[model samples]
Target: MDNMFRLMGSEEFSDRRRCIWVNGPVIIGAGPSGLATAACLHEQGVPFVVLERADCIASLWQRRTYDRIKLHLPKNVCQLPKMPFPENYPEYPTKRQFIDYLESYANRFDISPQFNECVQSARYDEVSGLWRIKTTTTSSIAGSEMEYICRWLVVATGENAERVVPEIDGLTTKFEGEVIHSCEYKSGEKYRGKSVLVVGCGNSGMEVSLDLANHNANPSMVVRSSVHVLPREIFGKATFEISMMLMKWLPLWLVDKLLLILAWLILGNLTKYGVKRPNMGPMELKVVTGKTPVLDIGAIEKIKSGDVDVVPGIKRFYRNHVEFVDGQRLNLDAVVLATGYRSNVPSWLQENDLFSKNGFPKSAFPNAWKGKSGLYAAGFTRKGLAGASADAVDIAQDIGNVWREDSKIHKMRSRVVYRRCISLA
Candidate 1:
């Protein structure tokens, strides 16, 4: 790799093009997917550099999530390749605990990432068969710039890079109350004794409403569309674990049917609690559309008990109240938009063909890790951490194969050149 770059003469390469060369792959984002990819590459004896925009690893888990957040999936399923959560951890670890676990995992493997370095842009140089990456470090006041060239580029930035706050009519100027997205929400202490309207009914929306209710806030949720709400546990075990076990033996249709029946028996009729259930089953929805089902913790109980009220989607916002689509209005002190996020992969990705019309990876699971023009996407899987780990393994294997083949070809070409030179001498 060094020799290939050295072969470029001064006439062909300018001083600006002589960037810091990284012989191996360059992994972006130091979250779960990035770290997992690094670990896999290390195991294959492949040297790589990890670049993190934040000051620490797992910035999403460390900063973006709310204080009371916890992993919806069980610890076993969420564990990385060889590192498992502490034995003493709860079935579902809290956000802080999960962040600690990530930190420990990175430290245990000696996976040191370049922190505070945000990737500004990456362009593939066809002539050199490498990726030219421009980055800006956040540590300095002037934002020092740096460049690097690598053979392969791995984009491990997860799905939730940018917050998606739905636009509401009259929300900007008419509403005088506080407005926030779920990403900015920490706790409900500031909302105490206030009538808060939480938009969207996903997992975060449900949990945040419950947190507000518990903290003395009169909370109401906006059920914009149909959603599948499931109990966190069934009988004596986690519902996710039960579903996984059933999936192993039963077909998808039958598994969905059984899970639906179980959910109906445990949670009773969601319609009775003003929560509208989608026509599709939870498992089916996840498999078909990749939409996450809201895993109920204590939110359903609160809703049924009249602590958290349910309302239709918002029509518009008023000076001191919000008008619902059903022609009803409620006086609210604040509005929390738990509308979720969109993938920011297109922001810095020069190759537009690598993304779909919706800006998501064009490829599906198992194949999503590989993209066009020597690009790879990680952590975009529907199965979350488990899917990401699997994708990392596939990516590492593919990269290793390509690298080996390229090395062999380069060696053959070098031998041919040497023989020709000896004959000329």
Candidate 2:
């Protein structure tokens, strides 16, 4: 790889257009997806820069997630491209354990990312056939703007960039109790004897409610619509592992039928507890609508044992009480909006082709990673870490091939970029 700017020393310049040129791709996140891509690229002898908005790698895991959250999937599927989890780790690693694994993986690969540099905007320069990325640093050298010009822009930011907070009627004005998103919530110790309203019945919501119930808090989970709740394990093996095994032999529909049959036999009918299954099978629903099924991990048992209440959607909030869609009203002390997350691509990425208005790639998984003008995505796949790892490997291989071809004739005496652009690690 060639360096466009030879002046590695800090310098000031008024010309903003003349930026530091990255000989390889400029990855957007320092999360698992981004780290995996960087490691794979390193193996291919490619030099790249990773820019993270946060101070540390895996900010979501380190700063945002609750303390009790573990890897929903098995460690085998959650591992990155090149590094495998430690043999001593549990089947489902804890949050801290997963973060530790990512740290070790980064250390093993010597992947140093430019931390606290948040990308403000990234646009493809049609004239230069390169991507121009503008960012602002939040570190001690704060409020300073920096730009990077690179041939490739790998968007490894992943699916959950921003937390989704729904605008419910009277949510802000009428509610007298404390309301916080799931990302902001860590534990239920403070809410020990209080009634907590948990919104959105996704995996996070279910898990959060379970945590609250375990902590001796009254948590009423709201099931707004139909959802698929599957057992985390079928018999003794992991349900996901069984699904993968069956997928290799049987058709998706057939596998779904078998899995549902097993789920029914094990968990019984969920309708009795106010839980409704979606019309589409779990896998089919996930593939068609990107809605993941809830893998039961003691939450359903809590609901069945009357430790956690399963309620309907919220109509509005009235003082310290919530009115459900089914005309049931209950007084609650706090509300935890486990509404999940969305991609921030549409907010900063100044492009229209590769990503849709909703910040997801227009194309589906597998094909969603690569796009025109060297734009790529890593973790947008609804299939979770396993899918993201697949995308990371594919991206590295593609960029490595081009880098190999370019190195054959790349010369040292190349034009240097202007002083305005900073060369980050």
Evaluated with lDDT, which candidate comes out highest? Answer: 2
Leading candidate by TM-score: 2
Displacement of the residue 38 alpha carbon in candidate 1, Å = 0.6
Please, what is the TM-score per model?
Answer: 0.92, 0.93
Q: Candidate 1 — which residues are off by over 4 angstroms?
A: 1-18, 403-425
Error of 2 at 307 (Å): 0.8
Whole-model lDDT for model 1 versus the true structure? 0.86
Per-residue C-alpha lDDT of model 1 across residues 217-300, encoded as one tens digit per residue: 999998878888888899978999999999999988898888888888988889877787788878888877899888999999
Output the worst ten-in-a-row residue range by lDDT, candidate 1. 3-12
RMSD of each: 3.1, 5.9
